[model samples]
Target: MKKVVLTTSLLAIAAAAQAQSSVTLYGRIDNGIQYENGSPQGHKIAAESGDWGCSWFGMQGSEDIGGGTAVIFQLEGQLNTQNGTSSGALFGRHATVGLTNENYGTFKLGNLGAGELQQDSWALDPQLMQRYAISTLTHGRNWPGIANGFEYTSPKWFGLTLKGQYDLSNNTNWNSGVLPAGQGRSDAIEAIYATGPLEVRVIYDELRSTQGNFNNLYAASRSIMGGGTYTLGPVKLWAGYQHLNAPQASDASVFGTDAVSAANLPGGVSAPTSADHEWGGAAWQVTPAATITGAVYHTNVNHGNGNATMYTLAATYNLSKRTFLYTEAAYLHNSSTSNIDLGNDSWGPNNYNGANNTTSGAGANNPDYGHSMTGVFAGIMTAF
Candidate 1:
């Protein structure tokens, strides 16, 4: 009888301990079929792993420390669902530990999701923030993330929230000797608001080369952007703009010019200078489990680069709360001096081997100026 009593007492203690902590595992798998036109090698079709959010799995846990405070940790990784392979990164997506306060906010250290830039994009895009569709066309794919740094997110104040992040060089040799190739600092600041049917955001992000190179060529890049969304019933509207600039290249870095050739560039045959981008979109919740999306994006670069424009439309039908079937179409039209491809988010010829000129180990391909691209894709996604 005494032993039974002791066992019950120990079990009660274990249950209490478990109540103070919790962990969850989550994942998503997406796959689809895609086709594109205007490829340098001609038309093509293929199956792809997809949805704007890459296929990934993650685990997160939290421990309550009393006093409205808790400790949190997460580990996530991207994977290719088509063939069951890692995205070449063990935990390429995230590996973070942080602290959260009920009234104060949250702070994190390690590889993070950066600022609120990505969340802001969802409001300003109708395609559910597809990476290659609306967002990439307007904003260059330069989210460095917090590789070796910290992030802070403030508690919401009347629908307003603030987030900031800094990426540091993990190296120890700083003031004494030569710096590493990518050993510079990257940082971002963002502000966001969400109130009933309205949402808004502003963000600033920058990266600087540590080499102290000359001629501003690939020396640094910066982005300043603002946008918001408004919803009326089942329909949501979005609008936003961004300004981006990269310093000019020097004589020693003239080879960098080859990276941005006539085919891919707006006008300048050299490295990127400054560019302006604008975008808008609409999302219609046609039914309780179905949605339609459409968006338009445009960009103009200095140095005779001219401009480029892209249009995208898509639809999603939910099989259940955790699964869906989707179809989408996209088109890209470039000015006489600009070369931008379309259907990048979907897959196939349009993005991989379009009309751009590229060599082995060369920079990304550029579509031929004045050329047009179009594509369509169908896919499904499931979350667990």
Candidate 2:
């Protein structure tokens, strides 16, 4: 009898300890077919992934460690559902370990996302940063991942919370340059305020290139964004503005020595120093499971780089709690000197920078300068 009682006590203790820890695996898969016109190579049709949203799998867990604090960890990776390939590394999306407390807040270390810059901007973006939304105009500068990062998120006080992140280049030269592991040293800070039906956020972030310079207007630059959303019944309104600057990108050298040519450069200038981007839109929940959204995004690039505007409409219908069908249509108009395309970070065949004078059908992903482009997409997404 004594032996049995002792064994039972040990089993109960083990069970109690196990109850203090928990883990969860979650992910989303999105795949779709896309059709577009106006690339230098002409119209094309293809299957794509992560157009409406990124397809990724991840596991997050936490352990209660007494004193109103807990240890938390997350490992996430993005994959192209169409090709079964990962984005960069095995866990490139996120790999973090942290401690959280209700009173003190959360502190994390390791490879991480752009914190609230990415989190809050999604909510504020009219198109949720989709394939042809905000990221498209700025060449995907708005969404960046960080490695060797340290992050801190403060607890909500009233309706306001604060967060910040710093990524170390992990080199001896402080901000020497982009390393094989990640970009040069970077930092960002954000503030968020949420009330009954409205939320607002502001962020300031910057990334550096070789010799700690902002060499690429879209790749290595500084950006400040402010935006907000208001909820009214079944309709939500979104508006935001962002400014990007890369002072070091003053000449054709940033693009490359062979990048400059008569096709792209009219006066031998092939670099953009600054840009202003703005967008606004609204979403309406027509029914319990359907939503319709419309938005406009515009960008004005300086240095004769011209400007572009995009108008888009999208809809989503939920088939179940974890699955949905989505469709969207968009049109992008580029100025006489600009070659912005319809897809995110799409710079076209000239991908070199400046405008391309090529009218030939080639291996280009976007249209020629001064041309217009249109696109349509349909896809299905599921989360688990």
Candidate 3:
């Protein structure tokens, strides 16, 4: 009887080991060719789609514990296929570990995407193959850094959830008379949400930076976004809205434009400023394999600075579950007489020029007139 009991105990241990949990490796490689136009100088054609999709690979794992508890972890990194270099910082995309319990909630640490952003992932414009694809340049806002941070997500209650994150700057030194080295440098947030056929999300962020003595800048940014998609057989329709506010501007000369300094202060002085932005869009599925999307984005800056309006349209055709072709274009108009131009910095040149070639005296060296951006992309993506 004792020998039989020992054998049974060994078998039970083996079974527990097998049932603990597992890890898996996964990733996607998306590439394509693109042609862009509307430069102040003219138009040019280069590599269409090399680093656009920003191909990447990652690993994820979870371990099951008794009584509905488990530990989970994910380490993802971006890859620049064009030149075969590290995406940026280590685990620039995401690096996180956490725990979850069916009867409780979840807690995570390390670099991770905001749950507020993920809430709308499913309702994004369908015409765009990759919403943030470097080549397309016609989709959502980009916040790439996943620095040191921690997050908590509550268990869903009646199809609703809550989540938040805090990022540490880890800086200790501050310039004399400044807000302090890490005063507003760290990233912090709070968010709330609900889901189902319709979903809503609200996110608040704090950003801070210090200049020289007697000069510092701090801003509180907040976004309220909501959208939903309802499917009717094989077709679905979706729409969303986002509102953003930046209440504090930089006072350092190095951070302000020559134009703003000269016009807003004495002897080209600098002070704090504010800005607000609103964005909305819609998407429609023309067929099971094709989609069309449209969006309008508007920005209003304080101090008679100026405003900008952008309209975008795009279409995508899925050749298969893993392959697709897409095209997108955008037209932006700087309507503010303040000569303030806020152009897209992710793709080409930075800064916006005024209508009459009046330099806003902004960062680097901005021209007088702001131009438009139009692009077309034809490529394929594969995932495994």
Candidate 4:
């Protein structure tokens, strides 16, 4: 009888412990067919993954330790669902451990998500920062993952909250120049306010080059972003503006410009020293499970690099709470000296077969300089 009573007591204790700890496995997969025209290689159709969103899986867990505190951790990675391929590195998306308290707020360290700028901008992007939206013109600058990162979040007070994030170089020389290409220290600060049907956010961030300078406007630079949203019943509106500057690249760099023909000076193209980007759009919930959005994005490059504009329309129909079908159509117009691609930035010379031209390295989808581009995509996405 004593043994039987002891066994029952042990089971009770185990059940109580289980109730205090929880874990969840979650993921999403997206795939689609895409069509585009305007590249020098001609029009083409292709199967694509991560066009509308990324395909990734993750596990998150938390244990309540009492006193309004908890220990938490997350592990996440990305994969190409179309071909069953991994996106390199296990847990490339996130590998983080943190702590949270009701009064002290939350803290995390490790490979966190993108910096505060990207996180804060998501709330104001009408297209949800899809492949063919805000990121297209900026060359995916807003979508990079953070490594060796530390982050902190403040508790909401009077509908206002704040966040800060820092990404370390992990090198002996702090923010060291000459470490390697694309290796630099970065940091950002963000503020957000939400009340009733209105929300707004502002973020400031900067990335240093391998030379410890803002040498590449599109790659290593400083940025200021301000945006917000307003919701009225079934409709929501979004608008934002961003300023980017790279004073160190007043001359030319590898990502700068080169002669497109013998008539022009060789290796004499000047890179953009500053730029202004703006976007605005609205989303309408036409039905309980259907949404449609339209938005315009524009970029003005300094130093006569010219400007470009993109117009896009997207629609989604939900078959279930966890599954949806989506489609988008877009058109991009580039000025005589500008060459911006649709969907994703090529991040290289815009001209075709120009001096030291390396558009092939980026992809064959880059259009010729002073040209236009059009694209359409249809895809299905599901979350589990």
TM-score of each: 0.86, 0.94, 0.74, 0.92
lDDT by residue for model 1 over 1-384, one digit each (tens)?
Answer: 999999999999899889989999999998998887764445668888865567989899999889989999988888899999987466656788999996999998886642324444555666766644655553333333336658889999999999888766555633111122233566778899999988998888765555432222122456777888999999989888877766644323333334333234333444446778888888899999999989888887666656788888888899999999988888888777655665432111223222244432231334555667778888999999
- Candidate 2 global lDDT: 0.82
Cα RMSD of all models vs. native, in order, equals 4.3, 2.2, 5.8, 3.0
Q: In model 1, what are the clashing residue pairs, if there are any?
A: 217-248, 217-249, 266-305, 266-337, 267-304, 267-305, 356-366
lDDT of 4 by residue, 282-380 (tens): 999999999999999999987767789999999999999999999999999988766667756524444321212233434456566677999999999
For each of the candidates, give the backbone clash count.
Answer: 7, 1, 9, 0
Judging by TM-score against the true structure, name the best candidate: 2
Q: Could you give candidate 3's per-residue lDDT for residues 1-384 as a string of tens digits?
A: 999999999999988877798888887766666555554443445443332255778888889877888999988777665566666555657788999997689998876642223323333433332432211221123232335567777888887676666665555542211222123334434343445455554544443444322122122233444444555554545554444433444443323444443443322223324445555566677888987777766665544445666566777788898767666665556542422322323211123221233322223222233334455555665666
Q: Which ranges of candidate 2 are over 4 A from the true structure?
A: 114-119, 179-181, 260-263, 346-363
Q: Candidate 3 regions off by >4 Å? A: 1-15, 48-53, 113-144, 173-196, 210-243, 251-272, 336-370
In candidate 1, which residue ranges exceed 4 Å CA deviation? Answer: 113-120, 138-143, 172-183, 210-220, 248-254, 257-268, 343-365
Could you arrange the candidates by TM-score from highest to lowest?
2, 4, 1, 3
Tens digits of lDDT, candidate 2, 1-384:
999999999999899879988899999999999999987777889999999999999999999999999999999988999999997788888899999999999999998863425545787797887897778888777887778888999999999999998888878987855622388888899999999989999988888875787877887788899999999999999999999988987554364554434345655345787999999999999999999999999999888888899999999999999999999899999887777777665223245345353643332655676789999999999999
Q: Candidate 4: where is the Cα deviation over 4 Å?
A: 177-182, 250-252, 255-269, 346-363
Error of 1 at 324 (Å): 0.6
lDDT of each: 0.67, 0.82, 0.50, 0.78
Output the worst ten-in-a-row residue range by lDDT, candidate 4.
351-360
* Candidate number achieving the greatest lDDT relative to the actual structure: 2
Give the 10-residue window scoring lowest on summed lDDT in candidate 1.
346-355
